[model samples]
Target: MVVRRRAAPPERCRPSPYGLRPGWDWTARAADAFGRAWHLADRYPYRGTEFDSSFVGIFRVDAADLFSAAPDLVNPAWAEATGQQLQDMVPSYDFHRLEQLPQVLVEAARESGALPAVRDGQMRTARVCGLRAWLHGYRRDQAGSLIPVDAVRWDGGVHHALSVTDDSTDAELAAAARRAEQDAAARGIKLIGASRWVEQLRAARRTAVREQLAGLRDEIAALEDRLKPARKRRTVLVTRILGWDGERDTDTALGRDAGLSHTAVRTLRTALEADQEDRGGEEGGPLAGLFR
Candidate 1:
C-alpha cells in the first residue's frame, strides 16, 4: 500500500500595489516627513525650501498619512533633515490639504509609476477621512513629465427619504380578516367557528379509547387460552405409563413414566394445582375441595 502525503499549509503573501513595505517606523517616518513639510510650507522663507522640507517630512510621517500635513518645526533638526529627505521623498508626497492625504498620496504613487495602476472604475469605494476630492495627476522627478491617474467620484452625503402610502380596499380587508382567522386556528387559538372543531376533537378521542379497550380484551383472551392445560394429552400419557407391562419401576413415575423431563413434569403439576385452586374459589362451596 502507498502512503499518502499531507499538503503543506499555505504561506502568507503580501498585498499587491507593493511600494515600500510599511511598518510602524515607516509610517511614523512618512507622517513626520509629511507633517514637517506642511509646517515648513508655513514657516520656511521660500516656496522651494518649504516644498523640499515637505518631502523630508514625508519620510518622518506615517505612510498612512503620507500626503497629510507636515510635522511642526518645533525641532530644527527635523526640519533640516526634511529638506534633504525631500530630495528623494518628493515623489512619495501626494499633497492632501487637510483630509484625503493618504488617498491623494496613493493616487499620486499610482500615477507617478511608483506603484502599479489598478483597473478602471476601481478604487471607487476607497475612502479617506477629511478628503474632499481625488487628485487626477502628479509631477515626478521634476522632469515636467506628468502622469495622469483616474479621479474617484465622491458622494459622501446625499440622502433620498422614502414615505409610506396606505391603499386598502374592501375586498383586501375581507381577505385579510379570513387570513387572520386561519392563522389563529394554526396557532391553537380559538377561531370564530371553533365549537364544531371542539366537538370533532372530543369524538376522535372517544374513538381512540374504545379501540384501545378492544385491543386489551383480545390480548387477555389470548393469554387465557395459552394458560389452559392439554387434558387429553395428559390423560393419555398417564394411562399409558401406568398400564405399561415393563418391569422397570421408573415407568410408574410421573415424569419418566410419561416420557418427559422432571422439570416439565413439575411445571405441569404446578399449573394444574393453580387451576384447581382457582376453580375451588369460583365454586364457593365445600364440594370444590373434592375437585382440588
Candidate 2:
C-alpha cells in the first residue's frame, strides 16, 4: 500500500485591523488555521474552549460598521476572518437569537471581567437596536460556504408564539392562527407577536384549500361523466313505466329502491329527459318523448 502525506496550510500572521489586544488576535489566527477544515470537513468537531462549556457568547461586531468605519481594513482576508472566525470557533454563540443577545453579553462580560463597547462616533444606539431587531436570528449562507441554519424555518419566536405539531397541515395551521388571532383580539393584544407569522399561516391555508377544492371539482366532474350513461338509461325506463300508469302520484315504487322521494325521482327523470332532448333526439324508447 502506498501512503501520501497531506501538506499543511501556509502560515498567516496578518496584523489585526480591529486593534486587538495580544490574545484577542485569536480571531484572525482561527480564520487562518481552521477556515480550510471548516470548509472541507463534512462534520468539523467543535474545539472545546472556556467559552463553550460556560455558555459564553461571542461579542458580535457589525461587518458593515467595520467596512464603513475602517474601509481601508476591509480586504478579502479581513472579511473572511470577521465573518467566519467566531462562527467556526464558537458555534454556541452562533446558535442564539438576537433577543437573547443582551443577556448573553451581560453574562459573558460578568464572567470575563470585560464589557463589550461601541465606539462613540459610530452610528447612534437607536439605529443599532432597530437594525438588530429587524435582523434578529437572521443568517444567510454565502456561495461556497457551509450550509447555514435556515433562520425562519427554525425560528424560536414562532415555536413560542403558537403550539403546532410536526404533521400539522396548512389548513390546521390556518385554523390555529385564526384561533390565536381571536384570543389575542379578545385580550386586546397585537397578533404581531410572531412577526407576520399569522399572515403566512393564513396564506398557506388559503393555497391548500384552493388546491383541495380544485381537486374535488375535477373528481366531481369525472363522477358526473361516469353517471351520464346510467342517468340516460333510468330516464328511458321511467318514461316507459310512467306510460304504463298515467298517474304520476301512484309511482311511489319508482324511487323507493333508490332511497329517493317520489317527487325527487320525477324531478330527476324530467331533468334527464330534458338533457337528452337538448343533446338532439331521445333515441332510447318509444315513450321517451311522451312524458315531456
Candidate 3:
C-alpha cells in the first residue's frame, strides 16, 4: 500500500475591508499611484522601507480594508522590489471610484488558472513579472479585447514559444547592430561589444583584488604565526601575576616583560591584590604569597 501526502491548499479570500479583495489588486493599484507619489516625492524622498510599507496601509483602507484582518498582505519581498511609492507622507488613498475588488480578483484568478477562481497570487516575484509587463503593454481603451494569462485560452502564448531568429527574420538583431553603431560613435566605449566590455571590466577588478589580497593574506598568516608563542607567554605571565598574592614590583616587572605601560601594570597588580584579599590572601590562600 502506498500513501501520498496532499498538496497544501491555497489561502481563502473571504469578504473583508483589507489588503486583498475579489475585484481589487493592491500591487497594481500601488504601482499605478507610484507616478503621482514620485511627482509629490520631489519635495521629500522616501526615507528607507517606509515607501513600501506605506503602500500596504493605503491598500488596507483604499483597496481592500485589509486593516480589519490579515493586514500584512503586501508581502515584503514584493513591496520592497516594487517601484511603487506613496504620494503622501501619510496614506490617504482615494480608490473608491475605481473600487471593484471582488470582480477584479475573480478575473485575475481565472487568468491565473486558479480553481473556483479565487484571488490574485503574489505578483511581485519574477515568476509573475512577465504577466505584469504584458498587461501594461495594452492601452486602457484596448483593455476590453486584451489577452489574459490562461493556459487554456492561450492568450499572449507566443511569448512562451521559443522562436529562433534566422538571418532572414533577424529584425531585432539588425536593430541591435544599428544601436551599437550609433552608441560606438556617440560614446567611445563598448566598441568590442557591450557584454565583452562589461566582462572585461569585471575580470580586471576581480584579478586586481584577488592578486593584492593573496599577498596580504600571506603576510597576515605569517604575522599571526609569529604572535602565537608571544600570546602563550603573555597568558602564562598574567596567570603567574594573579597568583602573586600582593606583590607590587612583580607587577612592574611583568609590565616591562609584557611591553605594557607601568601605570597599566600597577593597575593590574592592584586588581589582583584586591581579588586575593577578597579570597582570604591573609590565610595563605592558593592565590596568595607568590612574590611576597
Better of 1 and 3 by lDDT: 3
Consecutive 10-residue window with the lowest summed lDDT within model 1: 156-165
- Candidate 2 Cα outliers beyond 4 Å, as residue runs: 1-151, 155-193, 246-249, 258-260, 267-292
Model 3: per-residue Cα lDDT over 10-67, one tens digit each:
4462222233333433444453355346434432343343342232212212223222
Task: Answer with 2 or 3, whichever has the higher TM-score.
Answer: 2
Q: Residue-wise lDDT of candidate 2 within 157-182, one digit each (tens)?
A: 35433555444666666666566555
lDDT of 1 at 175: 47
Model 1: per-residue Cα lDDT at residue 206:
62
Give stretches of model 1 more than 4 Å off.
Answer: 1-192, 230-292
lDDT of 1: 0.36
Error of 3 at 45 (Å): 88
Q: Give the TM-score of candidate 2.
A: 0.33
Cα distance off (Å), candidate 2, residue 167: 15
lDDT, model 3, position 155: 26
The numbered model that scores best in TM-score is 2
The global C-alpha lDDT for each of the candidates, from Candidate 1 onward, is 0.36, 0.43, 0.39
Q: Would you give me the overall lDDT of model 3?
A: 0.39
